[model samples]
Target: MKTHDLTSLLEAMFHQSKEMILFVDRHGEIVYMNAEAEKTLDLSDYDRNQFINICGHCMGMAASGDPDCTTCFLMSKEKLTFQVYMRTRYGKRVTYIANFQQIDPENNISVFTLNPLSELMKQQEFEHQKLLTQRIIQAQENERKRISRDLHDGVTQELLNVLLEMRLFKYTKDREELDEKIEDSEEMLSHLLDYIRNISVELRPASLDDLGVEAALKTHFKWLQKQYGILVDFNTNLNKKRYRPEIETVIYRIIQEAAFNAVKYSGSDEIMVNLKEAGSYNGIEIHFEIEDEGAGFLMGAEPKGSGLGLFGMHERISSVDGELNIDSEPGRGTKVEGYIPVGERIV
Candidate 1:
């Protein structure tokens, strides 16, 4: 393209682009700003008599991951690109990615451009939530299949056996034989009831809602020992304390998942679990920890199983507006600990 045509195209883009563009002289004066910059920046506070300075809009320059502008970017013309917090039109400080470079050495002028960080963050959050939803759906499907298989293989088959025994009992020739058949059928029915109850408890233990998280966890730890060879060194100071149903559920499920993950992948025969209420200056916080010394995996490595466990652990904790931290390393132990800001329950 001819130089004249190219200049027009560039000028058109400079005005029409969504990003904010500004031209600054070495004196820190704002020579020009795009329409977006005028719309987004809080330039009203600055004096119009004296030229508006870029410092008026910039709260700080974020460099090397630090938000503090220890060294001013305006002083250096290093073809820099970094995060900056700029004052917005509404008197709020918003983060933006800034690209600045000296374009006119003779005039000591530079071009400064800004792209809002909020837009990029919003897009990232949307993608994260989309992935989380997909994983949750898949987890639910797997759980349903597990329950269905348990009913079919365990409860249903056993019930069928009892039904056949009853049908044969009526054809028994001797009184003693009939009595024995009836007893056998009763025993089978009793075992079938236990199997159904186990499945029900796994779905959502009634103890979790009725007795609270402490009781539910105690019961669960015992079951964990029986179901898996791994023993849980359980300790708690909850003392039958009650919490919001949602809080109780979140704590129980997180610890449960952490322990199960330990059992499946940690290669440890024993795990330690602690639930305590500690006094904090603000209020009281409920703290819990699950630790196991086993074949821990790298934090960002591909999970041996579905990565949904860790994702669900985070998702569950976040639902209660709590904090969580997981520490693990290869050949070292894993510790999953966090606190829920319940403080002391208000009387």
Candidate 2:
């Protein structure tokens, strides 16, 4: 193509672009605008060579006269670009990232360009929500730990001491009434101690840190069988010892969540938990699947509760650079699988 033809095509494309563009002279007068800008700001009344101040129409106020210019991020000449939400002539809110550049090397004739900031804002909002959810989970865990410690150290111990003192009194006094009361007190304390121990373990299983993953999981499965009567088929090919602490914690917690979900929602008599080494490799793969012949729902249907349980599980898996996959259908049990290439330093 000839140079003239290429020039004409470039100009036509620029003119027809959907992005709003405006060029202002050294004195801050509007000098040029693309087709979209005219429609965007209702610029039909604007005239050429007119002292067209776009302050009120484009950005809501004149550059030099607006009182907010002092704190407005756009006025920071040191920064070439910034983003803000501004009201347009159509009286609607729109986010825009503004870029300013000086056209003249020795003068202050700067050109300003704007691009919509909606996509960036959406991404930022998602990240903020993600962080907020994590903080909520941490706060909940802290509270649970507090309650567990109180029961284990204070309530349980105090009850035991009371029982001991009561037994000593039995030897000193020969009253039928007092003896019966002591027996009742002992029974109640026994039940309470058992309850407190369960609560403490649920809060944060000490076995998880003290014992390795294998031992902790064995205990967890026993608890599941005793409590829910759910037969969980567990298999381990872990020919290795211990894993990184954070990774272990993540795996344990996800298993807890997944298994709890299975018992609570899957309505299955039998489930499966498997942990094995990826053969001849340094990585490990963990799997927890719950299969049931129960009434299920659509996969896309909104989950019960705040729906953050699964989301939290996903985040935990991501922390270890792992992948989490959920498969569920109506009348079929849900299965959640997670794979983490073990030994990969997430940091």
Q: Give the number of the best model, judged by TM-score.
A: 1
If scored against the real structure, what TM-score would every candidate get? 0.75, 0.56
Across 32-80, the per-residue lDDT of candidate 2 in tens digits comes to: 7677766666644444433265454444322443424444432434345
Candidate 2: 10-residue stretch with minimal lDDT:
59-68
Q: What is the number of residue pairs that collide in model 1?
A: 1
lDDT of 1 by residue, 1-347 (tens): 54578788888988888999999999779998888878877557666743288877788877665567677778888556689998887778888988889999899999999988889889999999898788889889998999899989998899899999999986998999899999999999999989888999888899988888989998898889899877999999989888888889999999999999999999999999999999888878899999999999899898888788888889888988889999999999899999998855723
Which regions of candidate 1 deviate over 4 angstroms?
1-16, 22-32, 41-63, 67-94, 97-113, 279-284, 300-305, 318-322, 341-347
Overall local distance difference test of candidate 2: 0.68
**lDDT of every predicted structure (CA atoms):** 0.87, 0.68
